[model samples]
Target: MKAFNDFADRVRKEKREHYSKPVSYCLNYILVYIYEPITLNQLANMVNLHPNYLSTLFKKEIGVSFSEYVQKAKKLMKRNNS
Candidate 1:
């Protein structure tokens, strides 16, 4: 039973890590293309998720809406550039 519980815990952790992949990808893409225009739909398509779902997941993971995060990223880029 202990081994079974350990396996289950590991599985849950893996699933969480898997779910974070799309969010991470979006963050990296936004940072890499900070000057270019980006849309939720484009990112959703790139990540193979529905736009709405991605938006919800992104907000849940990052504590901000998709557009807000993008705007923040752009601002950060500008600050760093200067």
Candidate 2:
């Protein structure tokens, strides 16, 4: 599928950043919910973290703003017809 290829290409191109301790949990959460209807504020509340802090940490590790990542994911999902 084109969407899967896009996902694979992104995975191959973008090097993941390192995080530690409890914050790493957010990384896993982000990965699982990439294409879901979620926002930084929602995720911040879910993870019990401050919005600003979450945004900073997310961008630092993920190498993109949260909204940007979500947009790309949504595009991919649409491409895949999922």
Candidate 3:
């Protein structure tokens, strides 16, 4: 029973890590390249996901549309710089 429980925990952790890779990469990329023009297609291609699916997934994971997040990030950066 303990072995089975441990296996289940590991499986759950792996699943979370797998699904988060794209979102995580996207978060880092946007922050690092905040000033660069970023497009869904470009990020989707980099993450090897379909653009439409990535758009949906990104929104689901990040709690905002990609463009909205980028705009917010830009605003925050500008305010910090000023």
Candidate 4:
């Protein structure tokens, strides 16, 4: 029974991690095109998330505002010559 409980816990953790990856990837994808001079509403529609929800998730996971994250990602990409 203890082993079964441990397995369940591990699976739950893995599932959460898997779900989080796509959210992070989506943020990165959005950041990549953020410089194209589009409105926030348009980007939100493209990503299929509510603008408010996307803002909250971006802040929680990336430790910054969405705009800030885009700046940081652009800086890092430039540093890496990407």
TM per candidate: 0.74, 0.60, 0.76, 0.54
**What is the lDDT for 47 in model 2?**
78
Query: Any runs in candidate 4 off by more than 4 Å, and if so which?
Result: 1-22, 31-39
Select the stronger candidate by TM-score from 1 and 3: 3
lDDT of 3: 0.91
Model with the higher lDDT, candidate 1 or 3: 3
**Model 3 residue 40 CA deviation in Å:** 0.8
Which TM-score value belongs to model 3? 0.76
The model with the greatest lDDT is 3
> What is the Å distance of residue 79 in model 4 from its true position?
1.6
Stretches of candidate 3 off by over 4 Å are 1-19
Give the clashing residue pairs of candidate 1, or none: none
Q: Per-residue lDDT of 11-81 in model 1, one digit per residue for the tens?
A: 98886666488999998898888889999999999999999999999998777999998888888878988
| True-structure lDDT of candidate 1 | 0.90
lDDT of 3 by residue, 15-79 (tens): 76664889899999999999999988999999999999999998887779999999999999999
Query: Number of clashes in model 1?
Result: 0
Enumerate clash totals for all models, in the order shown: 0, 0, 0, 0
Please rank every candidate by TM-score, starting with the best.
Answer: 3, 1, 2, 4
Task: Say which prediction, candidate 1 or candidate 2, comes out ahead on TM-score.
Answer: 1
The whole-model lDDT of each prediction reads 0.90, 0.74, 0.91, 0.68
Q: Candidate 2, residues 1-82: lDDT per residue as tens digits?
A: 9999999888876645346433467656766876667778887887788999888877877678878877877788678885
